[model samples]
Target: MADTDLLKTPLHDLHAELGAKMVPFAGYEMPVQYPMGVKAEHLHTRAKAGLFDVSHMGQVELPDPNAARDLEQLVPGDLQSLEVGQMRYTMFTNENGGILDDLMVFRLERGLMVVVNAACKNLDIKHMSESLTGPVISHDDRALLALQGPSAEFALSALAPEVATLQFLTGKWIDVDGAKCLVTRSGYTGEDGYEISAPADQAEALARKLLAQDDVEAIGLGARDSLRLEAGLCLYGHDIDETTTPVEAALTWSIGKRRREEGGFPGADVIQKQIAEGTSRRRVGILPEGRAPAREGTEIQAPDGTTIGAITSGGFGPSLEAPVAMGYVASEHAAAGSAVNVVVRGKALPARTAKMPFVPNGYKR
Candidate 1:
């Protein structure tokens, strides 16, 4: 696509100012890396704090007294009992048990706020509109930013001291330099962090202020991808898609226990059956031996060269100083420590099934 055809986030100018290498991603001209490079940015984020421009993500507000009840019909999470200011990770499932998309649903004071992936926002909006009764208010005027790492709390507290009290998966509206912003103590990096949504007009200014903090530095998409990969978080298009079911993706935990028994959401029948009978395949982390990184599309093999699965997301773990990957494999091979092989560069490299989150999660909760 032409550069002119790409959409620009509110932080486009700021990214360029920081010497970021712009790339096209999810139909947006996004920053893939900065002058400091991916490794530096990744380590910096782990050691201190990093500011990420996640404004391309989609946000929607659904208002109602029974918003959770109404939204429960489309997703498997237990939204009905969700307390105000709480957030939950969930997926929009299709009738066949396939996942349409994964999202964060937050129970705000006035309604439910959902944040979806940038690529699927348009279709997600349409899907919600067709399935729900209440209005689905898309927040095109809002830009989202993420301040992630161990120093996140310390950095954000300087601007909004009230944010220091928020625990993981909790959100609240707070004032940042007089700008009303909704801040959530959650992020994709598996680090203790916050995702902030502010008016688009003020987003750049707010980001600049955050970047000015001693603990914060501008991070780009390259580091963000490696961070999430090391954390064992799924990337929408790569790790999951319309054909992957929550059961197969090792995400059944996202479904509430009551929802499992009651079986009301879409694909509940298949999901429940899998829960009872077990799935044929399951998502698991792969730790390849040696330094050679097994990348996405690499075929996973058994000891006998039997084809088992393919790598969905794979890369060098900056934090672990090793290669980490996640993919679907037969249920028998899903156990941690099970031996496996990865076909990389025409050679079967030794590997093993390992538990996820190559590095431990640092959520405040």
Candidate 2:
């Protein structure tokens, strides 16, 4: 869709004023990059702090008193065990065990605050409304933003001093520049950061405050994708989707141990079976030998030229200064150091399965 017809976030005008190159993404007109270009923005994010406008994503409130228990039935997380002000990364599974969508569930004092992907927000809410007999309210009046990197706390604390004490994966309602905001010490860039859910009207002002810091710069989606890729974070609809199971996607770590044994959520039986036994294939990091960056849909083959899988996410790692990729391959070939071939064009390119997080993660755990 064209930018004219796409939805605009609260910072849309601000992005334009910053000379951002707008692009249509997930039904929203979002910034892809600024005049500084993608490479510089990406490197700056690793060294300092980068501010991102993530308002296009959905913020929903599950207001039912039994929100935790009710939510447990939909996702494979131990939501009932979550302490107030805690957040979890989990996914909604289908009856057949495929991922419906990956979401962040935050336990709040009044109810649960959930963030879903922009593209899947509507469907996720619909799924929840039909699955659980609770009130699902979408907070369209809110805007989301992220400040990430080693200096994230320094940048955010200048405005909200209390934010400096927040631990990873924790949240609280606090005053940010006189505006009530839901602030969480979490981010998608594998850095020590905070995600702020602020009132729509105050979002732009809050963003400008953060950017005013000497360590912070406005980042766009282009650098966002590269940073997350280097961190081995999955991009919904690409790395994971309705056809991919959590086990196959190597996301078993996010599945709570209690949920593993209880077997209550969707596709529990199949997932449990896969957990005990094993799946035929598994997701693994691919290190392409040459400078040529392999892209998504590139074919994977064994040493003997037998086809095994295809690349789901692939790109050059700016942090590593080399080409890195990830794909699902046969279980036997999924181990690190196992040799594989990535067919970029017609030729089979030499590559190997390697440990993920192409760069070291900087999450302040």
Candidate 3:
């Protein structure tokens, strides 16, 4: 796509001023990395705090008293019972149990807020508009920013002290730089962080203020991808897709027990059966021997050369200082510590099915 055709975020100029390397991602010209480089930026985020311009992601609000109950028909989570200010991680499933996209559902005081992937936001909006019985209001006027890492609360607390009291997966409206913003104590980097949604016009100012903190540095998409990968969080269109079921992706934990017992959501029968009888294939963490990072599409095989499955997301885990990957494999070979081989460059490299979160999750629960 031409550079002119790429959309720019509210903080585009700021990213450019920081010498960020811009790249096209999900229909937007986003900063893939800054002058600090992916390795340094990633390490800095793990130790301190990293500010990211995630305005490309879509935010939508459902304004109806029955919003949660109406939205529950499309997802497996028990959204109807979600307390105000609570957030839940869920997937939109198709009739065949395949995931349309994974999203964060937040129950707000007046309604519900949903954060969807940049690529699938439109489709998700259309689906919700047609299926749900509420007014689906898209937040095109808002900019999303993520402040992540160990010192996230410290940096953000200076701006809004009430934010420091928020636990993981909870959010509330707060005053930041005199701007009324909705701040959530959740993020994709497996760290204790906040995803703040501010008015588009004031986003740049908020970002500038956050970046001014001693512990906060601007990070880009390159480190964002690597960080989420190390955290075992699935990237839409790569780790989880319309062809992949949540069960096959090993995300059954997000399904409520009541939903599991009483089928109501789309593909509930299929998902329940998979839960009862077990899925044929399972997503598992893969740790390759040595340093050759196995990338996406790498084929997985048994010791006997039997093709088991394939890798979906793989990369060098900066935190682990090793090559980490996740892929679907036959359930027989999906057990943690099970030995397998990954075919990279026509050679079968030894690997093992290790547990997920290559690095331990640092969420402040």
Q: By lDDT, who's the top model here?
A: 3
**Candidate 1 error regions (>4 Å):** none
Q: Taking the tens digit of each residue's C-alpha lDDT, what string does model 1 give over 1-365?
A: 99999999999999988999999999999999999999999999999999999999999999876779989999999998889999999999999889999999999887799999999999999999999999899999999999999999999999999999999999999998778999999999989999999999999999998999988999999999999999889999888998899989999889999999998999889999999999889999999999999999999999899999999999899899999999999998899999999999999999999998889999998
Which candidate do you rate higher for lDDT, 2 or 3? 3
Q: List the candidates' TM-scores in order.
A: 0.99, 0.99, 0.99
Clashes by residue pair, model 1: none
Worst ten-residue run, lDDT, model 1?
Answer: 63-72
Clash tally for model 1: 0
Off by over 4 Å in 2: none
Write candidate 3's Cα lDDT for 1-365 as tens digits: 99999999999999999999999999999999999999999999999999999999999999898899889899999897899999999999999999999999999987899999999999999999999878999999999999999999999999899998999999999999889999999999988899999999999999999999999999999999999999999999998998988899999999999899987999999999999999889999999999999999999999899999999999998988999999999999998999999999999999999998889989988
In the range 1-365, model 2's lDDT, one tens digit per residue, is 76578999999999999999999999999999999889889999999999999999999999887999999898998899889999999999998889999999999987799999999999999999998888999999999999999999988888889998889999899999999999999999888899999999999989888888889999999999999988898999888888889999999998989999998999999999999999999989999997988899999999999999999998888888899888899999999999999998799999999988888888877
